[model samples]
Target: MKKVAPPQCLQNAFEENGLTQIDVFEFPEGTHTAVDAAKAIGCNVSDIGKSLVFVTETLNPILIVMNGADQVDMNKAANLLGLPIRKAEATEVRETTGYVIGGVPPFGHAKPVETLIDKKLLEKDTVWLAAGTPKTVFSLSTRDLRDVTGIETGVDVSA
Candidate 1:
């Protein structure tokens, strides 16, 4: 069997952060949603930490990690961050994060940007997140996750 090449940025982040990388699974196109990703990984949807990329009116990029079953409350997020928030279009997401909409990881951006993590995601010991590609995901402990990624916890980004 042929092996798939891992996303370079994910590998780079693992190296930079001294993290023990988990396994990644690749699916065919159009499996970017949490439900579809869970199906591909043979896990529950809530186990997937949906990485949402948003842009402020200033054009600054930010990442939000939420439970797959939850939706981000933009108004609440804006109030928390004290900035006007807007859903980043596909073009802007790629331009700022160097990753497409469904594949934006919680960490390892081209540079550091503010990050907000939903409190609900803490329920699990480990959560799966995108690895710079729609078809790829990796599992990391929720506690140790911040060691490799700069995530601000206790934010209610979920609705």
Candidate 2:
């Protein structure tokens, strides 16, 4: 088996902030999808945090942290964000977030981005989330996650 390390920029993000070094676990089986992540981590799907990138009509990127078991209701999300949004293209995801689709973390980004966490995830004490790669993950407290993203409240954007 080969070892896969997360991007240096990602590691630096935690280090530079003086936060605990997030223990990233690698799964040869892959943790790209939320269901797959939950299976690999031995947790319920709802306990998995899925970070998604949505592009607003204005071409701005918003990172939405969602529960694995729920899907974003586009209409509700748009109403909450005050703009129409669509899933970002793969290229757009990488360019705006410095990450590929299956591994977009809730907070670290190439640039500062507005972020929102779903109320469902906020209800969990801890959840496993992708660690900047499709095959890696880490566990963090929901409170810490909220603090890191600077989103004090969660939104009801799930369908």
Q: Of the candidates shown, which would achieve the greatest TM-score relative to the real structure?
A: 2
60-79: candidate 1 lDDT, tens digit per residue: 88888889989999999999
Which ranges of candidate 1 are over 4 A from the true structure? 1-3
Indicate which candidate wins on lDDT. 2
Q: Which ten residues in a row have the lowest lDDT in candidate 2?
A: 1-10
Q: Provide TM-scores for the models.
A: 0.90, 0.94
Where does candidate 2 stray beyond 4 Å?
1-4
User: Number of backbone collisions per candidate, in order?
Assistant: 0, 0
lDDT of 2 by residue, 1-159 (tens): 234556777777667656565788889899999999988888899999999999999999988899999999999999999999999999998998898888887777888888889998999999988878899888889888877777778999999
What is candidate 2's local distance difference test score?
0.86
